[model samples]
Target chain A: MIHFLLKGVLHDRHRSLLPLIVITLGVALTVLGHAWVNGVLGESFVMSAHFSTGHLKAMTRAYAEEQDQMPIDLALIGVKEIMDELAGIGEVDWAPRIRFGGLIDFPDESGSTRSQGPATGFAVDLLTPGSKEIDRFNLTSSILSGHIPTREEEALITYDFAEKFHIQPGDRFTFFGSTMEGSMAFGNFIVAGTVRFGAEALDHGAILIDLTAGQRMLGMPDAAGEILGFFNNNRYDQKEAQAIADSFNARRSGSTDEFAPLMVTMRDQEGMAQLFDYTHIISAILITAFVLAMSVVLWNTGLIGGLRRYGEFGVRLALGEEKSHIYRTLIYEALLIGLIGSVIGTVVGLALALYLQVVGLDMGDAMRASTMMMPSVIRTQVTATDFWIGFIPGLFSMTLGNALSGLGIYKRSTAHLFKELEA
Target chain B: MENKQIIDINNLVKRFPIGDGYFTALQGITLRFVAGEFAGLVGPSGSGKTTLLNLIGSLDSPSEGSVVVLGHEVSRLSHRESAALRNYHIGFIFQTYNLLPVFSVYDNVEFPLLLQKRDAVGRRKAVMEALDWVGLSHKAQSRPAQLSGGECQRVSIARAMVKRPELVLADEPSANLDAKNSHHIIQTMKRLNRELGTTFLFATHDEKVMGYLDRIISLDDGRVARDERPLCVNEAQSDSTAEENGHARRQARI
Candidate 1:
């Protein structure tokens, strides 16, 4: 029965070819869309974990509410001892961030100072720099055009910000802020090399100053606002990480009164997970629509062809062929069609992915600069999983079309068949 | 066995709807035919001969009464059972010589055997013998479109008989052919019928077909008008044996 069905399909090759091509193309697009989403999310997760947040982050409860609402005084009270305790935990790689939010004052070309409209800046401890952890922050091959800040007198600014402020390496700039004692302080720092983090937002808005310099300017001593941890690989397992963080908080409640009120871990600081979910939903919708459209086209073509074969079906029935036999033959034909379509679709999808990956997707320079801190290329990457995703949809469409065509055989009656023969 | 009836119909009726009113295609037909007979069902166009033949062939069910063929009530059988009965015991020849255009003449003849679970060797012997009976063995490799009208009809005949069915129902088997092709097909069918002792039931309007049959059943408006058996060439020469048999049957009845 299968052999006969196959022979029939092959005998009508010209008629079946069009629908097969349409279904294959539909499946290919579906695969490419899913691959694109996976590529984006995977790259984003790596960037966030390695460079920005690590597997988890710990910050003051008030600072966790919102960055702007964070109190500058929260770090000065007993947080240093808590950081030491967390670092003592064998599974943790903790880094302290002495970050300050301030505006950079740009010197105009005429040598007159001008406001740079509240440009954000961060100050880190360069002495204890975690080179392995920090290497992930390198988005491009260029070495940021400057040296890291080594003293209170030296600072590093992002290249985009440096260009905007008319500042150069070795130039001096003034920083002003109130101390923790409620007194004003001012200092001048020589410009170090500018860094290009590749991220448009970070590149245009950030200035990096030495940690102690920022501490003196902000008037807080021996305190940092947050501790970022890179847990051992096992600790970073999503379920185990949440459980460990919760247990740690519970233990702190029994051990110390001051640590009880502190926020242990911040989950919302990791936007990468949310981005993954959002892209996946979009990809699913797009792929479904593509498959549905292809199914409709294939079904329509098959239906028309099957209807034209009604006379042949009628003759078979008159010759004592059962309805089941007719149906089985048609279904066999459909399966063969689907198999061919899936193979072609898989090849086409892989080819498309390779082509795009080579040429790259142009998301424009501004968007690239903005998200450059993330490592995924904007182009699609071809993978084995992508081929499967494309192939299944085509197989489904062909099966559905074949089932619909088989129904036409049941519409005929044996008595009417003899009438057709007489005609 | 000599008195057994191969086909029996009682009060058979077939009605169809036409423009909100009912039309009677066959109204209470009652008839029977015995085995070893070449019978003609003759009528003008729309005279209901084809309708009666369809009922006898088990291709349709009679609306009112019983259609019994070969000791089984056809209308009582399930659809699948009826199809099976047809495949096993009945053969059909159509006026259009309905051969599968895709298949060669040999494959077409081999088709009915496929419905059975016979192995390849048995199938090959049966198909070749049937083709040889129809005098079409030489054209076995040609497709239907490549054959002449008479050859195509011969192929249809071979496909029908390859299974060695008990009954063969032909519907206007020569309607598409010229006089020469029609005569050629009729002669081939008659030769196979005599040699194999198979029952043939033909529904046709052609007068040429009526002359060759041993029995003629004329139908008008779905009713049997006349049943007649004519003498064959051999029977006409053996007058003493026929009369002696008739006298013995009458004497035994008395």
Candidate 2:
């Protein structure tokens, strides 16, 4: 019986073709949009976590409040104690970092000032064994020339900054900055390499140095501005991070020290919560709007088709087929159509999404002046959920349309059908 | 089997709603049909023949009185039970040759058996037999759209006869055919009636269809005007002629 019905549907172009096409195109568009949005949100979260916030960050309460200003004066003391305590926890790695601003001076052969510029500097534990700082920053792949810092006085600057200064490896430069105690500090550093972080905000005028060199130059012994904790899997979990933060804060519960260590999750940072909420809302809106639109179109198609087949249904009813049986058969046919169309649409949509995932879209020109820490090239992320997401609207809308249309079967009386037949 | 009563209707009245009032289509109709009888309800358009036929077929319920077909009360049967009765014991042939356009003649004939849940082997055999009876075995693979009007009607007959139901209702079966094709369709139906012992009922005013029926029940203005058996009328005429011959011989002897 199903075989006969399938033949009927396949042979009758007027019955099945238009609805199939609509379902296929609608499902494909829905799948592609979902994956694209997911990719954008996932990438944005990863980029923010990588550059500005780790999975978790710990700093002094006073410094955290004014952390955006790079308050070296309120930097945390007894960093060795915090590092030791953080290291005892499993499934997490702790690293200390210092963010600072300084002035650079280039000298001529006659020992006179040639040129100078202001730059932002980041210092990490470069000389420590088994340190993940270089890999975490992805500096190995970002290096345009020369090598990473190998000594306390060695440093690496952004390739763009290097080109602007016409500086080469092994060139000595003077750095002038303030220490934690408000005294003027100075140091001479060798340019060991050049690197670019790909993000415009980080690659414009950036400098990198060893933690020991940074501590000595800033005159901040046994102190650090912030300590970052990264999960072993390199994926951020908001709940877990919050729990860890709560546990760490509870240890210092009621203390009056303004310089006490405070921990915060990545999502607790400025503007991040709104971004995630917007992403969720956008995904919901996009899928819902597409589904409703598809349903309306398919529903009209079903109603028109039913109207055109009034004679056919009349014949079947007169031939001893019950109205309920005919209605059920129509539903089965629509589901079959939905299944076929959804399969084809999923394949087409997935192919397009996979292409985007493989060969990402470059936004280098757009992001050149932007300060946001986002990658120059954006790629979509495909998850397991994308595989079956299209089936929801495809099957649901087609079945719903046909079910509404099939009600006409019961509305028609057999006597009227006979009159219709005679006519 | 010939005397077994298959349909019994008493004071059956059917009405249609028109503009907040009733348009009576059939009124005060009392009739009965026995098995193996080739009968027809003959009337002009709007004379309630089709309405009476629908009531007997259990397609509609009576507005006034009772209708019983195959021992099941037509007016009392639920939709499902009514459909079941038709599916198992009744077949219908239509003026328009309402064959499923998408299906071949073979499939159209096989459909009723499919509804009967007959196995595939039985369905194929019965379909071929019905097609052969209608002389459409060669056209079994042809679709209804590909066939002529007569051929399509032949397929319709095959479809109706495939399940070998106890009763067949044909409504104006020859109305859409030409003179020659009309005779051909009626002749095929007459042959099936003689061979299968299945009762056949028709709602039509077509003279060609009436000529082939053993019994003709004429209806007018939603009421039965006359009931006549043409063959029985012929037998009665012969008996009167024999009695007249005897009277003339006796008078000559006196």
Candidate 3:
């Protein structure tokens, strides 16, 4: 019976051709859709982890509350000691950064402040060979001007800021801001280079300086606003990272120090939590819609095929083939179609995803005016789920399609069919 | 009905609903058929021969009376039970030689045995033997579309006899064939009947088919009009009594 059915399907080009084509195209779209959704959401998360937030961040409660204000007085003290503990954990890599804002003064040969403008400064450990800051900013790819700062008092400014000030490498500048003690503090530095952050908000009036220079200028020893910890696995899964943060904080819940540091995962950050939640809901709705539409089309295909074979079905019934057996065989034939089609579709979809990942689609032109932290080229992110996600809709929709359509056969009486055969 | 009969029909009446009224296709069809008997319900169109054959095969239930084959009432059989009856005991042949177009001759012959869940070896042996009986063993691999009308009817006969069924019901088995093929098919069925002692019941208006039957149950206007049994092949072939009855039939028709 199986051999008979298989031969019938494979040899009957007229009946099988359209269903196979529909199944193949439907499965291909299903595979591609899953990969695209997983790619967009997964890449968005990793991008956020690398630039705006680490997998987890630790800071004093007061510092966290006033983090938007860049309050140096509320910054974590003994930053090296806290970072040492975080770094000892196998899954964690810690980086200390001082996010502060101040006025940058361009000095003439007279050593006086000639022109000044408000600038945001990120003081990071750039001298370390494997430092997280360099990778996080992807600074190597953004060097539009000279170079990243190698000297203690050298700074890397944004191309916009440099153009605004007509600044050049080796040009002298003075950074002036209030110290943690509310007293006067200032430092002079040479411009090292200019760079673009690939984000409109970050590329304007931004400067990068070494950590030691900022500490000296702030007049606050061993102080950083926060210690960012990245998970070594690089997935930065929010739920897992949040659980780890909760565990870490619980261990220090009895600490009497009012300024004690607390841990927060990436999900705790503003503007990101809602985005994460919406990603799942939107992907589910989109996937459901696609599956339903494809399944319905396949169902119609099965129904039309069944109608075309009405005589064959009637003959089978006359030959004493049970109704259930006929229905089951119909579904089995559908499964064969789905199995072949899904393999073809998955291969094509995976090929497309690989192409996008390796040779990313450049969105630079569209992104120039955008303030979001996403990179211009949005590459597909293939998770383990993408490997077999297509079968859910491919096999199921077709199986369900044929099964639903075959139900009409049961409704037809064998007597009626046998009589119809007489016609 | 005789106690030793393989199939017994008692007061069977079949009606098909047409619009608001019922069209009586069979009325009070009462008959008993014994083992090894080659019988045919001989009649013209609208004589309810096919309807009575359907009841005897358990493919359908009688509207008024009981059709008991092998002691199980056809009217009382569940769908599965009716299917099982056909699967194990009864085999059917159709007018158009309805060979499953997708299957080869061997598969078509092997179909009834497959329903009986016969092992591969057993099915192959039985199918080959039936095809040999029909003298189409050389065309075992050929599909129905690849065969001539005579060959297709021979395959249909092979399919019906492959399982060694106790009762074989044929509805106009020679209707689609020419005189040569029709004679050839009936001779093959007659040989199988004599050699295997399988009871045969045919629903046909074709005189060539009636010429081979050992027993003839003539029907007219949905009722049994005559019952006769020719003692030998010569008597069955001559069938002068049936020819005289045909005159009566025409008179009844007028």
Candidate 4:
């Protein structure tokens, strides 16, 4: 029976070609959409975790609440003790940063503020031979002009700010701000190198200084605004990260009398979990809509096939073929077409997916205008689920369409067969 | 052995709806056929020969009477029961040679045996024999559209006879054929009837078809106007013994 139906489909290109093309294109589009969504959203999430926040971070209770305000007064003190304890943990790397804001003075040989502007400052560990923080954010490639800073008295400033002040690589400047203890704090630093941060917010007004300089300038010894930690592999899972954070806190409770520091995974930091969930919901809605609309198109295709072949059905009935047999044969033909179409579409879609994965679509222009610190190229990622996801809708909707179309055969009266015969 | 009645029609009436009224195609028609007879119902255009044949074939039920084909009370049988009666006990050949256009000649001939659930080996044997009987063994792989009209009709005949049914109903089987093809078709059917003892009934006005029938039942205005035993040129009879022992009884028709 299957061979007979296959021959009929292969023989009648006029009747079967249109439906086969439609099913193939529909499945391909569905698979491409799923792969694109997973790729773009997955890359964006991982980039955000790597650059701005680590898989897990630690902050004092008061500091975590107002960390976004760059409150150096609420910073975690005695970070050395916390860093030592983290060293004993498994497969983790920790980095410390002092995020601050202060005025920078471009003095005119009189030791006075000739031209000054407020700047948001980042104080991170420099390459004291090898700083994990330098590699974590990939700051080396972001240099536009000068060399990286290696001394406590030298720093990297944004090229935009350097250009505004006509500051050269060896020029000196002063930063003055209130310390965490509410006392006057001052610093003198030479411009080491100008950098382009690539990120929109940071490129416009950033000042990077070594962690030792930031601690001295803020008048807080051995204090950091935040401690960021990532796994050795950098494959961050939110649930796993949260488990580590919770277990660390539980162990800290057993020993500490000083309100031991709290750990929070990246998702818990900024209501990011809900945002990630919404992306999945959007992807699901897109796939469901495509399936439903594709099913209706195929249902109409079945109806058209049936109406065109009413004469054939009549002849078969007159020749003593049972009505059920005729209807069932039509459905089996639809199943065979669906299987063939799905295989073709899957192969084509996967080919396109692999091409996109290797040769990504460049979004450099769009990236320049956005604040995300993501790579300029967006690529697709194909998985095992992509190959089979479209098959569910292909087989189910086509068979249902054929079955619905076959019901019309039962409505026809047996008298119609003889009338057709005499015609 | 040839006296067993396979079709019994009594007072059969068939009507068609015509613009809020009825047009009667067959009214008060009575007919009977036995196991191994070659018969044709002869008529003009408006006569009810084809309608009577349809009733006997159980393609449609009667409006007012009873038809019993192969033990089915035709009007009272369920759709499945009626289809089963047609599938196993009756075979049909039509004027248009309604061969399935997608199937090859071999497959077309094998259709009925497939419905009868014959084994693959038996189906192959039966299809080959039927094709050979119609002298179409060389055209087994040809499609209906590729065949000439006569060859298509032969394929149809092979399809009908492959199951070796007890009854064969043909409606205007030679209407579309030239005289040459017409003679070949009726001759093949006659040989099958004589050799296999299968009952044959036809509804046709073609005199070329009537000349080969063992019996002719003429219908006019939905009535049996004449019933006669016709002389078949292909049957060879011993003249003295044929006349002395009532030759019509040994001829082929009831």
Candidate 1 docking: what grade? acceptable
The lDDT values for all models are 0.69, 0.83, 0.80, 0.79
- Residue-level lDDT for A39 in candidate 2: 79
Positional deviation of B93 in candidate 4, in angstroms? 2.4
Q: Tell me the TM-score of each prediction against the true structure.
A: 0.74, 0.82, 0.77, 0.75
In the order shown, the candidates' Cα RMSDs to the true structure are 7.7, 7.1, 5.5, 7.1
Give the Cα-based TM-score of candidate 3 against the true structure.
Answer: 0.77
Ranking by lDDT: 2, 3, 4, 1
Clashing pairs in 1: A146-A193, A180-A219, A200-A369, A200-A370
Clashes of each: 4, 0, 1, 0
True lDDT of residue A36, candidate 1: 68
Q: Which of candidates 1 and 4 reaches a greater DockQ?
A: 4
Let me know the DockQ for model 3.
0.33
Rank by TM-score (best first): 2, 3, 4, 1
lDDT of 2 at A181: 92
DockQ winner between 2 and 3, please give it: 2
Residue pairs that clash (backbone atoms under 3 angstroms), model 2: none
DockQ of 4: 0.38
Model 4 reproduced share of reference interface contacts: 0.45
Top candidate by DockQ: 2
